[model samples]
Every structure is written in C-alpha cells, then in structure tokens.
Target: MDQTLSPGAAADYIAAQENKSLLRFLTCGSVDDGKSTLIGRLLYDTKLLFEDQLATLENDSRKHGTTGADLDFALLVDGLAAEREQGITIDVAYRFFATDTRKFIVADTPGHEQYTRNMATGASNSDLAVILVDARKGILTQTRRHSYIVSLLGIRHVVLAINKIDLVDFSQSVFEEIVAAYRSFAHDFGFETLVAIPLSARFGDNVIERSPHTPWYHGPVLLEHLEAVEVVRAAASRPFRLPVQWVNRPNLDFRGFSGTIASGVVRTGDPVVVASSGVTTRVKSIVTGDGERPEAEAGEAVTLTLADEVDASRGDVIAAAAARPDFSDQFAAHLIWMHEEPLLPGRSYLVKIGTRTVGASVTEIKHKVDVNSFQRLAAKTLALNEVGVVNFATLAPVAFDPFAAVPQTGSFIVIDRISNLTVGAGMIDFGLRRATNVHWQALEVTRQSRAAMKGQQPVVLWFTGLSGAGKSTIANIVEKKLHQLGRHTTMLDGDNVRHGLNKDLGFTSSDRVENIRRVAEVSRLFVDAGLIVLVSFISPFRAERAMARELLGPGEFVEIFVDTPLAVAESRDAKGLYKRARAGEIRNFTGIDSPYERPEAPEIVLEGGTTSPEALADEVVEYLQSRGYF
Candidate 1:
C-alpha cells in the first residue's frame, strides 16, 4: 500500500483514510513484559515511521538497546530521557498508524505498580486492550491488576498477546496453560471477546505476518484480527444525551445550546428535555461549524437551537424527552484513588462530572477490592492506586447515567479544593434512592425572618485550635458576654456534643472528619434558628474546616483560630489526655500523634498562649460590635 500517488489519487486516498473506522487500544502488562516493543513493532510493520525516525532509533539502540546487535524498537516509543535510561516506560506513549483497511490509535501504558494511575488513564478511552503476558512468567500480579482496571473501565475486547513465545520454544502447552489461568480469574470480567495470540515482538513473528516457528498454532495475525474486530459504538445505541457546555447567544433573535452529544442522536423537531429542570422543548435546528445539519449522533459536536427558549444552561443536560438520565445529589460509585494523600471518607472534594463541578464527599466506604484476588475487604480509607466502592453526596443534584450504560456522564474526577489537583477518578454505579426520596419541606418561617425577630444577624463563630488551647474557655466567655448584652447565643463544646451526638465515633482521622461534619451540620441548624452559635473544637484538618465554611452564607461563618504553641498546650493538659497520648495509651491524639492543620487565613487569630481568656473574649465581642452584631 504505497502512499505515493498522483494528485487525484492522493486526494482520493486522503478521503478514504478519513472514512476508515478508527480503533483505540492500549498495551499493558507487568514491567519487562514488552508493552513498548509490541507497539513499536506495530508501527514498524505498518511502515508509518520516517527515515529520520528509523536512523535515530538505530543510533539510540546502540546506546540503550537491550537486544544485542539489533534495533531496539522500544526506543521508538519510550521518548522520555528517564524512560530510555531506565529501560521502562514511565508515562503513557500514544502512537498513530494505519493499514489499508483501518486506522489505529495505540497507547503504550506503563506497567509498574506506582504508575497504575497512568495506565488507568490510558484505558479510560480505549475500546480494546492488548494485555501482553510473558510466556515464561505466565500470569503475574501486575498482569491481573491491569486486567482488572481494564474491566473496570468498560473495555470489552482483549487480545492476550503472549510475547516472547520464542523463549519458551513456542510451546503450545505453555500457551494453553496461561490462557486457562487467565480465563479462570477473568471469568467474571464480562469481556465480549478474548483472543490469545502467541508472538515475538522483537522478531516480528505473528504480529503482521504468519511465522513458521509456531507452525502448530493457527490464528489470525495480530494486525489482521485488529482490522477485522467489530467494536460497537455503545453511546450511539443508548438514549440521547447532550451535556450543555456553553449557552450560545450572539444576537437578540438567536440562542443555542452547544456541546458534544454524549449519546444517541438528535434531529430537527425532536422533543427534548432539560435533565435538571425537565423543561421540554423541540430541536429547531442543528448547527455545526461547517453548516446546518439535519441530524447528529454521539461524538459529534453541534449546537442545537430549541424550538422554545427554555432554561437550559451550562452544567445542564439536554436529552431525549422519552429517556432522560438520572438526576440526584447522591450516588454509589467505584473510585480509584490516585494521590499520595490517602482518600479520607467524609473529607470534602470537588467532583467534576459531565460539564458540571460540585462540592462532594465520600459519605461511606463500602469496601475495597483486592486487585489480585478480587476480594472485597473492609477499608476506612483508600491508599494510592487502591479501588474502593463508596457513596458520594454532592451539594446539588447532577444528571448522569450508570457508567456501564453511558460513560461520558457516569465517570468523574475528584479534585482537591485548595490545590485544585485531580486526586481520584470514579465511575457512578446508580443514583441512591434516598437522594430522590428526601425533599426540603418548605416553611413559612425562614432564617431571615427569625434573625429579624431577634434584631441581630445569625452567624456561626467557629473556634479551632490544639487540644487544651483554651478554645472552650474563650468561647464560653464570648457567649456569656453576648448573652449579657441581650444578644441570643449558644455554645456547642466538642466533648459535650460527642457525649450525645457523636458518641460512637472514635479519634481516628476518618472519625475526626465525621465528627466535625456532624458538628458543622448542627451549627448550620443553630444559625437557622437566629442564634450566634459558638463551636469550640479541635478541628484539625483544614479540608473539613473549609467544608464547614462553604455550608454557610457569605459573612455568616467566622473562623477564629486560637493560636497556642504545642508545648504550651501540652503543659496545660488538665485532662491528662496528653499524658496518655505520649505514653502510647491513646492513639490519634491531635498535637501528639495526629496532625492539626493551622488555619491559613482565619478571620481572627488570638494568641491563647500569651493572652488571657477574658482579653480574648473582649477582643471577639469588640469585633462583633464593630460589625453591628448587637
């Protein structure tokens, strides 16, 4: 298939290439299992490399090649200096190539356990997985781990490329044994197709052409199988979904919702509904950059002008009226934690799903999966690369479908709010029934009215500090002064509240998070009742404190940090808790074994170590008077 052609022939070839069906697949296995070499072999056999690339590869092979006196095909894709030096792929390397019949996009993913997140990213968008297994090594731990991730990400097809078969004398029995073991573990993976092929990637055997070394084996060559496999575009068969990325309005007479259709099809005069509001409308026209289109299906970006000017905005899903996605604020999902900081249940995070971002938290960890044995084990937190089934609660309802049904809407990334780094990825399973069942019962009385009756604004004064840091003492004094001044106030002490509201929670990091969460909710309720609520607690984690702040209205929550030196607080431990913590009797004691993240920017910072409790109380009262609280 020489690409050199006449002008007319070249134009025709370009057109044919554009129409060829594209396949996206990834190569994954344990380290040294030859993922990079397999992809390099594919590129070489397809003749997609230029003469300069070949010369560079040859020179680099002499410098870093593992194969003696032969070109190191792995050098072609392992472009990073560290990768070439280490002789292992660190990041995912993507390459494009084509045959006369089909076009292919292949991702050579890393195989080390530490880089599993990188591998999962590659698998997320792939339809097929080329899981290479060393013929001599059989099935290893990393092999199973990669396979589990592939299944979790909804890949349906797998090609078990048993590489280095020449090392095992191309033994048929060895191949069968490996395939049998794989099938035994992957029996429940639900793959539509699993084809096992024996190949030597370095020697180019059974990759693009048949080899005589393995005469006993009979199967389609790797390239032929890839070109013939039929991968159904699942989104095109499901219900219509278009998550509005932008609300387009350029003139007084025109308005359109622009987005890539996540699933199904849309046509002129077709009735559609907004997933958030259920506002029904018909598609007036489908507009593309090229021109107007009669219809558009999944993966096509188009602007849809509605027959009626309904309320569809960004973060809203526009879908076929007959079949709409689930709208809920809570759901169960499987999360893959990808950060050095372990995922703590009840800690706040930002969830980016579809075109929407919302404040969310993992309400519960049902269990974590052991990738090796696929066993479900109890877990309070997920470490890096660990997968867990958890329940998530969002601040607002989101429109989505189950990942198995619609991936674009179901998958999401978890971001750290302060740093804005992606810490995890998850796939939604289903909407929680309780999320839809619970409704806010409206009342004639409201917070504004209650505050007006009290003749003062409602606010929550959050006092956070180390243990024995005089938080409760200072808070009590502030509340008493406010009460004497005829301003209604209430104080919630950490030890007192735990005796009733959170008695069952322990002092672990996870329990501490839940403790603050419960207290935050109680403070919110107290604020609604028009009382200046004082919360005194050792709220160590900054993330939980930020969550509490977000729960209140602007200027309604004041964070007061009781700054005290650790030595000073420990010496003033009248409760003897510090003694027990230092003697190893108590675990997870803040300022001892646990951490206390100091407030980065609190409204007020009082030096409890140097100042008297009365003086701190007066400072708080004076600040309140200046703000017109009384």
Candidate 2:
C-alpha cells in the first residue's frame, strides 16, 4: 500500500472500502497498565503511522521516553501535553485504523478513578472492550471496576489482555490463574464472550505479530483475533423504532420524518404509530441523503414519508403499530452519577434519550452498587462515580424499551436544568408497574364526602424554615389546639419521622429533598382521610416544595414559611446542632454549611423569633377558621 495519496483519491478509496465491517473497541485498565502502549503498538505494527509522524515520534520518544534508548510506544496515543508530561492518559482519545479484514475505531480511555466517567463514555459506544491487566498485578480493583462498567453498558464481548508478560516471565500458569479468578467472580455477569490473552505490549509480543516469547500460548495475536471476531448485528427482527430527530420540510410538497433507526427495520408501507400520540400511519417511502431506498435497518439514518398526514414531529417516536414500545412518565433505572454535585432527589432535570428531551426528577434512589464488591448498599443520594438503582418521573410520558432489549432507546442522560451540564447517565430497567398497569380506582365515598362527615375541609399546613427555628414547636401547639377543638389532625414532625420512615437518609441536600418528598406524600394521604396534616420540616429547596404542592389537589396544600433569622436559630440551638454545625462537626447542615433557600411567597409568614409558639399556633388556628376549615 502507498504511504501517501492525493486528497480526493484518498477520500474515494476510503468511501469505497465500506464493504469491510467496522469494529468499535476500547482499551481500559488501571493506571500504569500500558493501555496506551498496547494501542500505540497496534497502530505501529499495522503500518498506519506516516513517515513524518514516525520521525517526530522517534525524536519525541528520546526526549520524553520513560525507558532509556527505547521508543516509548505510549507516545503514539497520548497526544495531550498534560498526558505526555504526566505519562498517563487523562481523556478518552479515539483513533481510526484498519487491517486487511476490518476497519477499527479504537478508544484509549483513562484509567484513573476520577476519570471513570470518561471511560464509561467511551464504553457506551464500543462494541468490544479490551480490558488490560498487568501480569505482575493481576485483577486489581480498577480492573474489576472497568469490567463492571463495560458489562453495565451492555458490551458482551470482552478481551482480558494480560499485558507486561515479560515482567511475569510469560508463565502460562500465572495467566491461567488470573483468568480462572476472573471467571469465578464474573460467573453471573452474563458476558457472551470472554477471551484471555497473555502478551507483552511493550516489546510488541503477540500484539500485531506472533512472538516466540510466548511459545506456550497458541491463541491468535490481538489483531488476528480482532479481525476474525464476528460482529453482532442489531436486532432487525424486532419491532421497528425510529425516534424522529428532524421533520424534513424542505419543500411544501415533501414531508418526512428523519432519524436513525434505533432498532428493527422500516420498509415502505410498514404500519407505524407515533409513540407519544398513538397516531397510526403507513410509511410511504424511505429516503436517504443519496435517494429513496426500499428499506432501512437499525443504525441507518434515513427519512420516511408517511402515507397520510399525521401528528409526527421531532421528539416523537415512530414504531411498529402492533408492537409499540412502552411509553411512561415513570421508570426504574440504573444511574451513574457523573457530576461533582451529588444527585438530589426531587430536583428537576432534563432527561434526554434518543431525540426526546423532557423535564425529569430522581423520585427515589433504591440503592447504590459498590462496583468493586457488587454489593447493594442503601443510599439516599448518589455521589460522583457512584452507581445506583433509582426511580425517575418525567413531566410527560416518553417512549423507551428496557435497556436489555434496545440499547439506543433505553439509555438516557440527565442534564442539570440550571447548568445544562450532563450530570448522570441512566439505563432504563423497566417502567414502573403502577405507572403503566394500575388505573385509578374510583370510590363511592370520596375525599369530599370524608371532609363533609368531619364537618371541615381537609388541608396540609407545610411549615419550612431553618433548623431550630421553632417550626416543630409551633406545629406541636397547633396540633394540640386542633385536637382540643375536635378537629381531625396529625402532625408529621421531620425529626420524629426520620427515626423510622427516613432512617436511611442523612442530612445532605439530596437526602433532605427525599425527606420532604416522603413527608408530603404521607401528608397527602392524611388529608385524604379528612385530617388537617401539619408537616414541619427544614425543606430548604424551593423546587422540591413546589413539587409537593403540585402533588396535591387544588387548595389542599398551604405553604407557611417560618421566617426566623439564622443568628436567632443558632442562639437558640436546642440540640446543640447549631454549635456543632458551626464547629464543622456536621456537614450539609442548613444555615451553616449548606444553603437555605427562602420561599419567595407563602400563604403566611410568622416570625418565630418574635412570637411565642402558642401565639403562632393561635394565628394558624384563626387562619384555618377563616378558610371555613373549623
């Protein structure tokens, strides 16, 4: 093959080479595991480097090489100056190369713990993961972490490359022992293919060519195995799904829904239904950038003209009419927290999947998974690099398949509404049964009937303020006065509930949101029972409070802001919590470490510092009486 060609000829030749299947793969391992070196060696042996590039590599290796008088192969892949200076990969760098049999896109991902999110980004699009293990340090924690993430991302094909074989004397027994240990631990992970290869990537042994250094190993070299591996095509036999990315209306005469087929196949005259609106139509034609096509399969970007004008727009999903994907406003999913700010339950975010984006919130966190141990640890919030099972609620129903069924439609990203930065990645486990299967059961005796029987209207009085601001005190007095007045009532004190209902939650912003959520739900139930529910908690976030209000029926929720100065609360530190928070003994404590967002408007504002608890309770009772809730 010629080393150089004219620009136009090169482009033509590359385009003509589409007959070859392309494999997208990545290399991942712990720090100093030679992932970059292995990729550098692969590129070098494949003759992909140009003469000028090689010359520069040779000169740079002399100046920056870790090994004396030997070219540092890692320099070929670690292109960033910081990476070169630190001698470690920090970002996921992608490179394109080809062998005689297949074209390849190789991702060199960082291995540091802090950069695990970057590794996950690379693994999400990869077909195979080449997980490197240092022969001398076999099966470290990070190796397990990388494998777990690859499995989570649904990469079934994995190659355990035992690099640095020279350091371990190329011992076949050592390689076998490591492989056995890994297989034992991953018995339940359900990987379709797992191949273990022992090779020295630095010396170019068993990388691109067969090396006599590992004469005991008879398996094919890395490149040979990669070229021969069968590619797993998408499931074209399943129901068709095309998430409309754009509505093509270039001219008044032609209208088409343009998007990449997420799964299955679409042909002319195929009956399709809009997932969001349930509007059914038949496909009239399939058009691509080149021209009209008879059919299109998954992974192919094409446009489809409907037989009749129907409600089809961007963010709407088109699928087979008979087997439409599940559409729901609620789902159970596995979430990987990616942002430095911990994920707060009940905080609204943008959930983006396929071409659809909608308002969403992490309604509940079921549990966090310890990647190294695979243990399900109870957690109220997910911190950076933590993985958890959670429940998500979107503002409106969105179409999706379970991740196990369709990778493209089932996966999504969580974007912070304020920053618009991607904060988490999620895979849909399944839609919540209550959200899909259960319908509201109408009762003969309704909430209004219960209120009439009690001779009063049911309502929830939500008191929110800084800690030790007399919310609980005022609430307790109000509940007592209501009880004496024969008014049906129940008081949900925040600290009292935490002793049982919210025992698993801490005082982090995420946990506080969840605490308020649980309380508001319980209060709603109480109100349904024709009781005046008093919910007193340090619900610091205004968004979560708004959500609570939205969860109730009209005029059922009332926000009573307990306005008290932070200095006044600290001075009256009943539990000594304020002193402890000021002393740094407690973290995420509102008015000390965390922020306390004041409610912009409330039905009532009582100065807890100036008024007695009894007087505040009397004021609340007067307001309730004025509202005809005697």
Candidate 3:
C-alpha cells in the first residue's frame, strides 16, 4: 500500500496540524552579534525552507558571504535588497516555522541604535525574547538594553543565548562567568523563566540538537527549552472586556455590537454594561461567523445583541456587569518616542487605543531612561528612540485596564495631527484616580446664566506676537474700551503673570508651552464667569494657540496676530530684550534664538509698528460686535 495520502487529505492534514499551540519570540542583540544568523540556522535545521529558497541562498552566499565557500545563513533572514548588500538587518523581519511539539514565530529585529523603535515593535506582541550575546564579548550594553525593553513589554520568559562559543573553544568557565554577570544585573527584572544556553549558531550546535562541545552542560538543547517553556495565554481567564469596533445594523430591525473578545468569556443572557456610558443591559444573543453561538471566549470575534438598545457605538466597551474597568481622562504611562522631532509637552496628538481615538497631550515628563546605563535622567523632552515616564491628559474619558492586567486596552499610539504619522507609542502603567475624583461640580448658575445676567457674551481675545510687537499696548486699549462700555473685563498681561503665576518658567521651549497653558486655563475660568479676558502673550508656537482655542467654546476665543517685522521690533527694543538676546544674555528669546510662528489665519491682524493701538483696539471691538458678542 502507498504511504502518501491524496491531495485533499493532505490539505486537511496540514490544516489540522496548524492548530498546535504557537510560540512567538524575538531575537535582539548588538550589531554583528549574529541574530539573523541564529534565526536562519534554526529554520534550516528544522527543515522549514524549500529547495528553491536553499538554492538561491547558496548562490547569494557565494557572492556576499564573508566566509568563503561557507553558507551564509544570515542571508536567509535578511530579506531586503539593502539589507543583503549591507549584510545587516534594517527592519524587523518575521519568520514562521513549526516543530512537532509547537509552532513558532520568530522576529529578527535590527541591532542598530537608530532601529530601537523597530525592536520595540517586534517585542510588543512577542511572548518571549532571545537576547543573543557573542561569547567573545559577553554581556555588552546591547544585551542589557534588549533585556530592559523585553521586561518593559511584560515578557515573562527570556533565553540568554551566548552564541559564537566555538571562538572561545567552548570554555565552561567563560560561559559560567557570563551567566553570573547577566544574572546579577537582571535579577531585579522578576522574570518567571530565564534560561542560559552556550552554543555556536554558525555551526548549528545546541540549536536544534544538543551539542557535544558543551560537555559540562546538562540542560536541554535550545529547541527543547523553547518547546517546554510555558507562557501565559493572553487575557483568557480575566474579566470580560470587548471594545466595540463596529455597530452592525444591516437593517432597521437588527442591531449588534461587533468586536473580538479581549478577555474572559461571554454567553447568551449574560449581564453586560457599556464601559464608557455605564448603561446596563443583558446580552440577548451571541452571533459568530458560523452563526449564533451559546458562548464566546477570549480572542473570538462575535457580534453581541443587547436585550435593550443603549447609546453604545464604536469605541465603547462591553464588559461583564459585575466586573468593569476603570475610566479616566488622565494616566501615567511609559512613552517610547519614535519620531525625529522631540516631543513638545503641550502639543496635542491623537491617541489611539483599541477602537477609540482622543486628543491627548503629555503634560509632564517625569524622567527618561538612559538605555546604556539603565539610569533615570531628568529630561524636558524626549528625542528619537528615547523612553520616558510621562503624565498624559486626554480630552475625553477612556476605559482601560493596567497593562499588567490587560495589554489590549492599555497600549496606545500617539499620532501627529498635521503629519498623520505615529510619533510615539505608550503603555499605560495605571490610571490616575485624581482624573475621576476631580469632577466638575454642577451649579445652577452656569456660564450661560452668568452671561445672561451680565447682558453680554463671554469672550477671550488672545493677542500673540513677537517680544516688542505692541500686543500689550493693543490689549490695554481694548480692555479700557470694554471698561468704558460698562462690560466686565480683565487683562492677563504676560509679564505680570510671569512675575507670579509663571515665575518658575523660563525662556526655554518647554517652559514657554507651560506658560501658555497656565494663561489659557486662567482665561477659561474668566470666560466661565462671563467676563471678557484679554490674554496678551508672545505665545510663539501655533500649536499652543490652537490648544487655547480648543479650550474655549466655539467663537469665544479670538486670535489676534500682532504683525511686526523683526527689524522693527529689534530697532524699538522697548525693554532691551531683543538686544540682550542678540548679545547672548537671553537664550531662547523669540525673534532671536527661538522661533515666532506667525498665525496662518487670525481673527484680527494689526501692523503693530505702524498701526495705532487705539485703531487696532477699535478693529477688535468691531469684530466682537459683528460676531454678536454684545
């Protein structure tokens, strides 16, 4: 009888074999540490590559191999043309292979300092990590860096692969010394499993099979250890959380909330509540692709029909009624900066987590990590590839759990508004209780009621320009005019505020942002009281001004640009600030060392050096009156 099965049976057998438990891991080390080579050797020894792929690899090795007549296994994992030419991996390359016991997915991450972001991206979804170190140069800075990152990402299992042991003649004392050094530094990481293996990946020793070179070692081979290590399955036994990704309403008669179960389980008739709105309803049915089901577990995609219609939509979460997650508008998170431009604290970005996106800003940088030394350093802003602990403030409340409890709802991406590019990734350490504790106490007398009593509309006239741009002079005139007209008004002069409210702030870019933030918050309070607030400041950044505009009600915030040439402002030098800035006495002074971003389209523009203050004030008042402010 023939042993081979038919094509149809073979397809079924292959599909059945794919149902094995999977392990996802990554290999990270310094440049020339042989990470790609190790991954390539694993695939080759496991017989995962096809004949044509091996043939091509052999040909490529002849042309590009550093070792003559030897197969360059690294060529198999380095997929890009540039990577092949440079003999280095630039991006994260994922490869899949299966052993008889378990399936495996391995990420070969770049080892360059500039590609730290790529390494982080690979670690985000991995269950374990392999920190490879060359035995000749054991426990370098890159090894510690990779270990720190994998721990930050909450990977419990780690394998310390000391490769190139053949170069050291497979010395047991060297392997023991390196293992002891790594354990001393990484003991505080709290890894559930840490295994050390000494082998030479270039020779395929102790990779798929045990090596005779390490006669002193009694542990299982690398493949055996990988297959036996136990990793926690994601969110399977925790509280139920399903972030609503879509609202399925094909017809008027049917409605369902569709999302994959992020954690725990759900069954028909289970009591569920909306995480954002807190509306309780029982689950009427659980619908899956195969049709209605009795129950749905974590990682399963299903549509849930509620017994009663509620205000649930995309970005909402449906959780078991008895166990609901915390909701807050503020959180402390670890931010990995990924962009070339440094992060500006007050600048707003669209933060996305699960199905929701909200306007958020990094309010404060607690500290940044020095990856090389593992030391915490005080930093005002984060540059590319830097990691920092930051306080984030969102415009609206979002439901989330601690990353340790559930990763799906706790991770987020920060996208630049103008560029629509991801600038940072954040992991929510925990939500700040103050965010929910500090609630707006409702009062019978509100902004509308106050405005009605005053018989005028509340407004904030934001006057922005260079240092000597006559903004203060024009704002003073406007306040005087409002005072004469029997309207309630107040002026927040920049210099006056700096004398007290912002005394600690300086001329640095970060300090300037905070200064504007304080002024805007105070202006908001004044507007709520139904008083016209005149904010005169050289708030140079356009993003800061835009944030102020968003803080106020529609049409309440008016941007008035004081257009004055730098030469004119310099010549005037009313307070000698420009001259001092030129003499290097004042650093980060706008129109000198720092930048002054002119408003692209302002409600009012005054040629400050040419136009009279009274005229400019009259034009502002005219704009207010035209817009029905009085």
- What CA root-mean-square deviation does each model show from the true structure? 2.0, 5.6, 2.9
Of 1 and 3, the candidate ahead on TM-score is 1
Q: All models: lDDT?
A: 0.94, 0.89, 0.89
Q: TM-score of each candidate?
A: 0.96, 0.79, 0.91
lDDT string for model 3 (278-350, tens) is 8999999999999999999999999999999899889989998999887889999989899997898978788
Higher-TM-score candidate of 1 and 2 = 1
Candidate 2 lDDT over residue span 208-325, tens digit each: 8888888888888899889988868666766799999999999999999999998999889999999988899899999998899889998899999999998878999999999989
> 181-231 in candidate 1: lDDT tens per residue?
999999999999999999999999999999999898898889999999999
CA displacement after TM-score superposition, residue 168 of candidate 2 (Å): 1.6
Q: Per lDDT, what order, best first?
A: 1, 3, 2
Residue 242, model 2: lDDT of: 96
Q: Which residue ranges in model 2 land beyond 4 Å of their true spot? A: 1-16, 235-237, 250-254, 344-348, 362-367, 375-377, 435-437, 440-510, 518-538, 542-577, 583-588, 595-630
**RMSD (CA, angstroms), candidate 2:** 5.6
Best candidate according to lDDT:
1
